[model samples]
Structure formats: C-alpha cells, structure tokens
Target: MITIERVSQVPEDFLVDNPEGGAFYRAYGRAGIPDFELGCFIVKRASRPVTTAPFFIMKLPLNTMMPPGFLKTLLGRIALRVAFVGHPSADVGRIQGEQSAEVLELINSELRKLAPLVSYKGFDGSLGLAKFNKVIGLPVPVLNLPPDYWNRLKHKVRTDLKRKLKASAGLRLLETDGLPKEHLQRVYELYRQTCDNADIQFEQLNVAYFRESAPLSKYVLYFEGDLLIGFHQLLCSKQIMYCKYIGMDYGKSRQYKLYFALMLQAINICIRDGIRQIDFGVTSYAFKRHVGSEMHQTFNYFQHRNAWVNALLKRLSFLLEPDESELR
Candidate 1:
C-alpha cells in the first residue's frame, strides 16, 4: 500500500537529510515568484517508509474579458494547457530503489489531481522514467577530475588553460559568500543579456534568489581591476560540483576569455578539494566537449491529466518541448 501527502512548505530537516534536496531548490522556493507555489509530495510505501519530492505549481491566469460561464471555464482550460504546453509543474528530486516506477507513478498521479500536467525535469535517464512516457535525451556535459587532473587533459586544452590564466593577469578571482547588492544588480543585468542571447529560454532568476542562497554555496567572482567581469555559483554534493549559474560581460568575455578562465578556475578548485566531477550544466556543448567533458543524458518525463490533451502531446512532443538541435 502507498499513501501520499502534499504540503505547502517542506521541513528544514528534510532537505538536510536528502542529498538531492539542495540549495538550488530551497532558494527557488524562497524566490517568491508570483502565481508559483512550492510544495512537496511525500510518498510512503510498504517497503520504504518515506520518499519526498519537491515541486513547483504554477497557476494559470484567466482571461479577464471572458464572462463567468461555461465558455469561460472551457477557454480557461485551453489557456492553461497552452500556457504549460512546453513547461509543466516541475518535480526536483531523484527516485531510487527497486520500486522507483511505482513511486514515480504515485507522485504523478497525485500531481495530476491538482494540475492538468506534471513533469519530472532533468532526471537521470537510467531511472526507468521512459516506461511512463517518451524520454528525451537531454545530455549535460561533465568533466571528471582524476588525481593528476591537469596532465589528464588534452595537450591543446592544457595549453589554452595556461594561456588564458596568464592573460588574466590583472583579473582577480575572489571566492566569497555573496556579492553586494549593487554587484548582484550588475550581475543580474549581465545574466539578462546572456539569457536574451540564448537559443533556449526558461525561467529567469531574480536578485533575491542570489541574495538568499549566497551563504549555502560558494560564489566565484572574476574582477578586472575594480569591475566585475564574470561570476560562477557552485553547488556541491558528495563528489560532484554543479556549476549552477554563471554570467559574464560580453565585452570583457572575448578580451579576457572570462568563461573559459572561470571554468579553469572551477577545475582547479575541484582538483584541490578532491571533487570528482564538475557538472557544466546544459548548452555550450562544443566548448564543454573540447575541454575533455563527457556527456550524460538527462530525461524529462511528463503526463497530462486530460486524455485528449495527453494524446495530442504524444504526437506533438517535439513541438511542445525544447528542440535538441537548439543546444548544439
């Protein structure tokens, strides 16, 4: 037998207990985005007493001009489906063990009761989510650091890293708990520019998120004299260090190769700390691959509450989701 419990706020100890429940999700919950509610689904099974997954419920807006009638309700449903066509309520946790399928189905079944559609985003493909729906191959590049890390890299990569490090003579890399309010605002502007230029668009981060989550993780800031040219936010779990968020000034990026330099710095940090893997997040595949990173596939599994909508999604899944080519 299985039971499910939904709560508006997750307990503090829950995050501490689960390795998957990290600062990113906790910070996202505190971001206070309007119409978005953060909650967790607790699944209790006969074999395992408790399993929890955090999710974001995004409320769809109704058209004010629509009169209060059957037509309004009908249009509202359509609008909701369309608004969340590509994006569904996101589940941010991993399901492990032999009963993983049953556990995932239970969580999805519960989520379907509240939202018309639900998705588990960016999970490991090996977890058997493909049985429920079409599993897309969304791979993220990761670089594994061996004991003799620098020598393990290709000769070209090692040469470039050294050259970039030497060229970044005046640039000082500072590891701090957080940036000042003004510096965060500047970083936000740079982040906006980076997002605007991206081929893929997703959630936008606010300054509040940066401020609230600063103490939980390490921040690496690159300064060219007094000006902040770039910054990288890192989150560590066990042996892996996730490069969660990064932003760089375009003008300074080319001149200083700020992105590559920051990446090299992250590698050095990982090697020193004995962190095995550095997850370089999605996108910029070519550069990441060039630097001896191996790609690991991530999957997003989704289901719709409505049968007709679900059928439509099965046929047009490519159109509804992000194009894989866009990343390349």
Candidate 2:
C-alpha cells in the first residue's frame, strides 16, 4: 500500500539529500508565487523508505455564485476539475525506481480527494511519463558550449554581438546579490513590458520573488549612465547556468541592441566559469537557434479523477494548446 503525506514545509536536509529535486526547489519556499501554497508530498510504501515530491498547490474556486441545491452538487463536480498542481518552476520533477506510474496514480488519487483535475508540469519528455496521463510537449532551447564556443557562433551572430558590444560601451555591467528598491521596481517594470510583448504568456514575477530569490541567483545588471537599461537573472547550480529571467527597457533595447549584448554576456560568463550548458528557457527560438542552441522537449501531464472528463480533456487538449510550429 502507498500512503502520501502533505506538509506545509520540508526539512532542509531533505532538499540537500535529493539532488533529483533539482535547484528550483532549493529556494522555492521563499520565492512567493502568488495564489499557490508551497508544499511537499511524501510517498511511503509499507516497509520501504519514503520518497518526497515538492509541488505548488493551487486552490481554485468551484463556483463563484454558490449554485443552489442540485445545481451546486452538479457544478461542484466540475469545479473539482479546476484545481491545479504543478512544479514550482521549469525542469523539476522526480520519482524513484520503477515507481513513476505508481507515484502518479497515487498523486491523482490524492488530488481527487480535493479536486477533480490536476496537472504536473515541466517533466522531461524522455521520462515516458505519457503512459499514465495526457502529455503535451513544450520544447525549450538550450545552448551546449564546446571549447572555443565564441567561434562556433554564426557569422551574422558574431558581427551582431560585436556591434552591440561596441554600442553598449556606455553601459556598465554589475553583478549583485540585491538591488535597491527603486532599481528593483524598474526591473519589475521592464519584466512586465517584456511579458506583455510575448506571443505566449506565462508566469509574471513579482518584486518579492526577485528579492527573495536573489541570494541563489546572480543578477547581471546593465546600467546606462545612472539608469538601469536591462538585467538578466542567472540561476547557478552545479555546472549549469540557467537563464531564468530577464528584463530590458524596450525603447532603448532596440536602439542599443541590449538583448544581444545581454545574451553575449551570459555566454561569456558561462565560458569563463566552465559551465557545461545554458538552459535558455522558452520562446525567442530563432535567435537562440542562430546562436547554437538546440531544442529539448519538455512535457506537461494532465488527468481528471472523473474518467469522462479525463477522456474529454485528452481529446480537446489540442485545441487549447499552443502550436508547436511557433517554436520554429
């Protein structure tokens, strides 16, 4: 028999011991994602030791109008399908041994007790997680740097980077663990602008998220004179430097080619530090591809406690999902 335990907080040692939990969970408790509760699910099987999975539980509303009598009962069933559970961030999920199927079954069983629907996000496609749930592919671009990485870049990319570097001479790059409140506020604004301009929207970071996550991250801030023009948040763990977040002044970004400059800076940092790979995150596929980044497919799995609803979701998922062609 498998028993699952939910806890509001996880022990520090648990994170230290489980490298499979990945780096995002290392500081997730303090990241302050809105409308989500940070917690871990412990899976215990009879005499065997326990396994833990960290996740963000998102409580969703059943019905805003509190349906009357029979209507309430009917809509409540549908509402149960509204609740969601997912990884705290990109590329994090773990289940031990041959128990991936069992763990997922147990999780879905547990979620049904609270809500009708639940989804696990950001599992690598290579895991074969699709066997038990409807899986969708979300490909992310990554750059694997070989020695002399700079010379491998396309001619156009190299020329563009040099031009941008020369044009950005007035800018000073500063790495810091914290930013002033005003600077933080400007960064937030640039982040918001970047999100607003995106073809597909995802999480929008708040100031608290940045302030709290700063300790685990290296903030590469580009300052033009006294003004903050752009910044890149690089999450460092082991030999991988993930380009987790970025923000820039839209108007000046185009004029001075701030994006190219920032990307080049990130590459230079990785080369100097001997980082193996850079997870460039999603979107901006063309530019990342031109600069030698390869595509790795990520997966999201969904299931509903109600078999009928689960079947319907599996069929209609394509309509609601993004077009893979967009990545090209």
Candidate 3:
C-alpha cells in the first residue's frame, strides 16, 4: 500500500543522507528550501518495510487555493494513503518514481481525473537531458576564477573597476559574517529596484530570510555606506558554489563595473579556498557570459491529467512564445 502524508518538514538528514534519492526527488518535485511545505509518499508492501518517495507535494504560496481538507478528502477515496499538500509554485501534481512508460501513463490517468480542480507541473531533469539548439545545464559546475584571468581582462573592465574603487567613498565590502542590519536593508532596496527594472515581480522577502541565510552561507557580499549598493549570496558544498542571488545598483554604478568586481571577487575567494565550480545561477545575463561562464537551460514539465485539460494544454503550449528576444 502507498500512503501519502503531508510533512511539515523534509528533514535535512533525509536530503543529505540519500544523495541519489535527493537528486531523483528534486528532479520530479521540490518541496523547496527552508519553511516551505512539502509532502512525501511512503510505499510499502506486505513483506517489505516502508520506503518514502517524492510524490505529490506543494512548495508553497503557489497553490494556496487547494485546502488541506480537499486534498485529504480526495486522497481518501483513492488507494493512495497519504498526500503532500500546498503548491510551492501554484503548480501541483502527482509524483512517482523513476518515470517509466507505465508510471507516467498511470500518473497521467490520475491527473486526468483531477483535471478540473488541479494543474500539474514540475522541475525535472528535462533541462539537462534535453538536446537543444541553445543552452544546456550540466550538474551545477564547481568553478574558481583562474589566476591572471583578471590581469588579461579588457582594459575597459579594469578601468571601470578602478574608477569604482576610487569613488566608493565609504563603501565597505562586508563578508557574510558581520554584515550590519542597515547594510542588508540597502541591499534589499537595490535588489528590489533591479527586479523592477527587469519588470519581474517577486514575492517580497523579509529581513528574516537575509538575516538567517547571510551568515550561514559561504558567500554573502554587501557594499555598504550611504547606499546599500550591492548584495550577493552564494550557496556551496565542498566543491561547488552557486551564485544564488545578487542585487546591485546598476544605474548608479553601471559604468563602474561594481557587479564585475563582485563576480571576480567571488571567483577569487573560491580559488583561494579550493572551491572548484561557481554556478552563477540561472540567467543569460551578459555579465555572466562575459565572465566566461557558460549557459544552462532549466525547464518546467507540465502534465495535465484530464482529456479536456490535456487537450487544452496542448493548444496552450502551442501558443507559448518566447517572452524575451534573447534568452540569456
């Protein structure tokens, strides 16, 4: 019997202890990091013990409309004994194991039934696995900036950095530790402005998120003074560092190449510390390419269950147009 349960938390040990499982689970679904709601399905047979698998779970703030009562009631009627709740992205669906022909078909059937009430999608291996004309992602590459690379930079890049350093006034580059409260507030302001310029609307992040992750993560940079002009966050393992989030005052400092300096600084730090790869995160941003970083494509997999909705989705997919002129 398979029982699905809504878990308040997906233990950290579970993710670290089961690398292959974690990778697999992340491929089909993500409960998301810290404080997001996640669900797991425990499968058991008459003789075998319980084994937890990533089934249908929600990340959060996305599928808030699907209440707990509705999910529980629906699951009870089916053979499924448990259900993970909430849409971390407002994307919901049923999750199964290493997707086989039969398993996908079965999932498709169940989704067909829930067609009217729910929509299903996921972050799968589709991106790395797909053969595309443009970009592809490998396992997050561990990178360190090569020594002397900075020396060979175009005269323009070097001049920009020098100019900024000279005029930085009271700008102090604080490491992840000892970052002051006022500093973060300014960084967040810069980040918000950047998002606005890009016409991207993001869930507002509270100071708590920055305060909590800043010191804990390996790289958190902030340029502080009258303005909180720059902020960057990096996530890392022993060998790999992900340039997770960054905010900067491009308008005020665009000509100064403050962002470039920040990126180079990250690379230098990584090299010094023996960190191998820097996953400058998603975005075909020109600066990322200028840093000699390659591009990787991440994809979303949407599977609609109902015949009507499935048909509806196919048409919608056809209508899907590239939102940007160049995906960088």
Give the RMSD in angstroms, all C-alphas superposed, for model 2: 6.5
Report every candidate's CA lDDT. Answer: 0.66, 0.67, 0.45
For 1-328, candidate 3 gives per-residue lDDT tens digits of 4333334333333445322224323422331334432454333345342443343432223222122345435533332111222233222122333444433333334433433322223233432211111211112222345656568768887676556545543457666643466666776676667656542221344455555555435544545444557767655565666565567787755644566656766777777777666777543366566556655443344433345754664464422222342243
Clashes of each: 0, 1, 19
| CA lDDT for candidate 2 | 0.67
lDDT string for model 2 (144-182, tens) is 887688787778878876877777777888877555556
- Clash pairs for candidate 1: none
Point out the worst 10-residue segment of candidate 2 by lDDT: 59-68
Candidate 1 lDDT tens digits, 6-57: 7665555555633334445566677765456667766777745476676666
Total backbone clashes of model 2?
1
Candidate of highest TM-score: 2
* Better model by lDDT: candidate 1 vs candidate 3: 1
TM-score of each: 0.81, 0.82, 0.61
- Candidate 3: regions farther than 4 A off: 1-3, 17-170, 178-184, 219-226, 318-326
Worst 10 residues of 1 by lDDT: 82-91
Error of 1 at 200 (Å): 1.5
TM-score of 3: 0.61
